[model samples]
Target: MKAALVGADGALLYEVRRATGRERGPDAVVEGILGFAAELRAYGAEHFGESALAAGVAVPGIVDAENGIAVYAANLGWRDVPMRALLAERLGGVPVALGHDVRTGGLAEGRLGAGRGADRFMFIPLGTGIAGAIGIGGTIEAGAHGYAGEIGHVVVRPDGPECGCRQRGCLETLASAAAVSRAWAAASGDPEADAADCAKAVESGDPEAVRVWLDAVDALAAGLVTALTLLDPRTLIIGGGLAEAGETLFTPLRAAVEERVTFQKLPEIVPAALGDTAGCLGAGLLAWDLVAPADGPAAVTGSGAP
Candidate 1:
C-alpha cells in the first residue's frame, strides 16, 4: 500500500510503503491500510505540526466513488468495503476520499505529469491487466457507473484467449503485459520468461519475441483506435510495466495506431512521466481537492523534504 501526507498545494510532505499482507486475508489487508494511514496522520502531526486536513486512498478494482466503497477487487479479495468511512473514522473524522487506482493515477498524470495541458486525455496502464482512466478538464470521469475507461475489455480479436472479465478476444487477453509474458514464455521455452525479458529479446532481434511483441501491439492499437474514435482525447498516456520497454512499445504502437486512424485526430502518445508514484501523488491531489479551491491547480511536486 502507498500512503502520504499531502500539503494543500499538493506537496507530498511524507510517504511510506508497506506490504498489504493479503495472505492474512482481505480483512487483514483493510486493517493494514487503516493502520498505515493512522501512522501517517500521527507522523504528520508530529513532524509538520498538524494532522492532515484530509486523506485520500487509491485502490484497485471496482470502486463506488460516490459512496466511497471498494465494491470489488479480485486481486485484493475485497468486496463492499466502506473504505472512506473506515478511514475517516480511524483518523478522527477527517474527510476521506477513495478512488480507483488507475483513475487516481491518471488524475496526477493529467494535472501534473504527461497530460498536464491536454483538456481531454486518456491514461492506460498495461500491467498484469489493462485498465484506463479518462481525464476531462481537471477531473477524472467516473462514468455513470464508475467504469468509464475500461478499454482493455474491448474485443480486438474474434478468436483469442479468454479474459478474467469472462470474455474471449478481449484487448487485454492479447495485449496486456501478462499476455505478452505468457506468449514469450511459450515461444522462448522458458516458463519464467516475462514481458521484460520479451522486450530484451525484441531489442536483440529475436524472431519469436518480435512476433509476440507485434501481436500485442496490434491488439493494443486496435483497442486504442476504438477508444480514440469515441473519446477523441488530446493526449494518450501509456503507462505500467509494458511501457517500461520505452520505444520498443511506443515506436510500433505509434505506427500501428497511425495505420488504423481515419477521421479521428490522432492524439500525441507519450509514456507516463510520473512512473509508479502517480497513484500516490494522485491520492494527494484528491485529498488536496477537498481542501483547496476548486479552481486552483494541484501545484504538487514530490521533491519536497521527506
Candidate 2:
C-alpha cells in the first residue's frame, strides 16, 4: 500500500509504503489499513499541526464506489467491505472517498499526468493483469455498476487462454505482462524468464522473442482498437511493467494499431508519466475533491489498495 499526506495544491506533503499483508487474511489486511491511517493522522498532526480533513482510498477489483463497498477482490479476498464507513469512523468521522484503483490512477493521469488537457482519454495498464480507466474531462466514468473501462476482459480470441474472470481469450490473458512472462518462460526454456528478458531478446534480434513480443503487441492492439472504436478517446495512456520497454513496445504497437484502424482517428498513444505513484496521487485528488472550497489547506490522507 502507498499512503500519503497531500496538500490542497496537489503536492505530496509526506509519503510512506506498507505491505498489504494479504497473506495474513482479509481481516488482517483491514486492520493494517486502519492502523496505517491512524498512524498517518497522528503524523500529520505532529508535523503539520492538524488532522487530515478528508481521506480517499483506492482498491482493486469490483468496487461499489457509490456505497463505498469493496464488492469483491479475488486476489485480496475481500467481499462487500464497507471501506469508506470504516475509514471515516477510524478517522473520527472525517469524510472519506473510496475509488477503484485503475480509475483512481486514471483520474490522476487525466488531470495531472499524460492525459492532462485531454477531455476524453483512456488509461490502460498492462501489468500482472490488464485494466483500464476511462477519463471524461477530469473524472473517470465508473459506469452504472462500477465495471466501466474493463477493456481487458474483451474477448479478442475465443479459443485463447482462460482468464480469472472465467472467460476464454480475454485481452489480459493474451497480452498482459504475466502472460508475456509465461510465454517467454516457455519459449526460452527458462523457468524464471520474464517479460523484461523477452524484451531484451527482442532487442537482440532473437526470432522467438520477436515472435512472442509481436504476438502480445498484436493482441494488445486488437484490444485497444476495440476500445478506440467505442470510446473515441482523444488520448490513450499506456502504463504498467510491460510499457517499461519504451519504444521497443511503442513503435510496433503504434504500427499495429494503425494497421487495424480504418475510420477511427488515431489517438496519441503515450507512456504514463507518474508510474507507480499515479494511484497515490489520484487517491489524494479524491480526498481533495471531497473538501469544500472553504476548507482551508485541505490537509488530506490517501491510500492505495493492493
Candidate 3:
C-alpha cells in the first residue's frame, strides 16, 4: 500500500509505502490502511502545521464508493469492510472519499494527463492485472454497483489461457503484463524474466520473445477493438508497467487495432503521462473535492498533475 500527503494545492508533501500484510490475514490489511491513514494525518498536522480537511483513499477490489465500503478484495481477502467510515473515525471525523485504485489513476490521467482534452476516454492499464477506467467529462463512471470498468474480464481468446477470475481466455490471461512476463519466462527458461525482459529480447531479435510479444499484442488489440466498438471513446489511454516498453508496444498495438477497425472511428492510443503517481495524485484530487465547496475556490492546480 502507498499513501501520499498532498497539500491543498495538490502538491505531494510526503509519501510512504507499506506492505498490505495479507499473510497476516484480512483484518491486518484493513488495520494497516487505517493506521497509515491516521499516521499520515498526524504527520501532516505536526510537520506542516496544517490540519488536513479531508482524506481520500484508493483501494483495489470491488469498492462501493457511494457507501464508502470495500465490498470485496480477493488479494486483500476482505469483504464489506467500511474503509471510509473507519478512516473518518480514526482521523477524528475527517471527511474521507473511497475510490478504486485503477479508477482513481484514470481520474488523474483524464483530468491532468493523457486524456486532458478528450471528451470521452478510456484508461487501460496493462499491468500485473488488466483493468480499465472509463472517463467521461470530469469524472469516471463507477457504474451502479461500482464494477464498471473491468476490461480484464473481457474474453479475447476463448482457448488461450486461464485467468485468476476463473475465466478462460480473459484479456488479462492473454495480454496483461503478468501474462506476458510468465509466457516469456517460460519460453526463455529464465525464472526472473518479466515483461520488460521480453521487450528487450524482442529488440535483440530473439524469435521466442517476438512470438510471445506478438501473441500478447494480438490479444490486447482484439480486446481493445472490442472496447472501442462498445465505448467509442475519443481517446484510449494506455498505462502501467508494460507501457514503459514505449513504441515497442504501441507501434504494433496501433497497427493491429487499425487492421481490426472497420466502421468505428480510430481514437488516439497514447501512453499515460502520469507514471506511478497517478493514483496518489488522484487520491489528493478526491480529498480536495471533499473540502472545497462546489462554488468555492478551487485548488491551485486544477488538473492535480503532481
Candidate 4:
C-alpha cells in the first residue's frame, strides 16, 4: 500500500510505500492502512498545526463506493471489506472516501490533467492488467455495480490466450504490458524477457518484436474503437508503463483508431500528466471534495480548474 499526506494546496507533504502483507490476510492490511493514516495525521499535527479533515483510500477490484464496501479484490483475497467504516473508526470518526484505483486516476486526469475540459473522456492504464476510467461532465460514471469502466476484459480475439479472470482473448490478454512481454518471451524463446525488452527490440527493428508490438497495438485499437463507438468520448488519455513509449505507441495507435472510424469524431489521444501519482492525487481530491464546504468552491492548485 502507498500513503501520502497531501496538503490543502495540493502539494505532497509526505509519502511512503509499504506492503499490504496479503499473506497475513485482509485484517492485517486494514490495520496497516489505519496505522499509516494515523501516522500521517500525527505528522500533520506536529508540523502543520492541523489535522486532515477527511481521508480518501483507493483500492483495486470491485468497489461499492456508495456502500463503502470493497466488494472484491482477487489479489488481496478480500470480499466485502467495509473499508470506509473501518477507516472512519480508526481515524476518530472522520469521513472516509473509498474508490477504485483506476476510476480515481481517471478522475484526477479528467479534472486536473490531460482530460481537462473534456465532456467525455476515457483513461486507460496499461499496467500489469489493463482497465479504464470513464468520465462525463467532470463526474466519473461508476456503473450501478461500480464496474462500468472495466474495458480490459472485453473480448477482442475469440481464440486468444486464457486470462486470470478465467476468460480467453480478452483485451487484457493481448494489449496489457504484461501480456506483451509474455507474448514476446514465448515467441522468441526468451523466458526472462519483459515488455521493456520487447520495446527495445521493436526499436531495433527485430522481426519478432515488430510482430508482437503490432499485434498488441491492433488488439488495443480494436477495443478502443469499440469504446469510441459506445461512449463517444472527446479524449482518450493513456497512462501506465506502456505509455512511456510515447510516439512509439501513440503514432500507430492513433492511425489504427482513425482507420476503424468511419463517421464518428475522433477523440484526441494523449498521455497522462500526473503519471503514477494520479491515483494518490485523485484520492486526495475525492476526500477534499467530500469535506469541503458545499456552499463555496474549494481552493485548487496545480492544473485543476474549479
Alpha carbon lDDT of each predicted model: 0.90, 0.90, 0.88, 0.86
After aligning candidate 4 to the native by TM-score, how far in Å is the CA of 54 from where it should be?
0.5
Output the better candidate (1/4) by lDDT: 1
Best by lDDT: 2
Model 3 spans > 4 angstroms off:
293-306
91 in model 3: Cα distance from truth in Å? 0.5
lDDT of 4 at 5: 72
When superposed on Cα atoms, how far off is each prediction in RMSD?
A: 2.2, 3.6, 2.5, 2.8
Per-residue lDDT of 101-140 in model 2, one digit per residue for the tens?
9999998888778998898999999999999999986788
Of the pair 2 and 3, which is ahead by lDDT? 2
Candidate 3 clashes between residue pairs 3 or more apart in a chain or in different chains: none
TM-score of 1: 0.96
Instruction: Give the worst 10-residue stretch by lDDT in candidate 2.
Output: 297-306
Q: Per-residue lDDT of 1-306 in model 4, one digit per residue for the tens?
A: 777777555556777788888789888887888898888877777777778888889999989999899999888888999999998998899888999999998988887789888889999999999999999987788998789988899999989999888899999999999999899899889999988888888889999898999999999999999899899999999999888888889999999999989888899999988888889877877777776622111344443211
Tens-digit lDDT track of model 3 for 27-120: 9988888898888888887887777778899989889999999999888888999999999999899889999999999988887789888889
Sorted by lDDT (best first), the order is 2, 1, 3, 4
The worst-scoring run of ten residues by lDDT in candidate 4 lies at: 293-302
Q: List the candidates' TM-scores in order.
A: 0.96, 0.95, 0.93, 0.94
lDDT for model 2 comes to 0.90
Error of 1 at 120 (Å): 0.6
Over all chains combined, what TM-score does candidate 2 have? 0.95
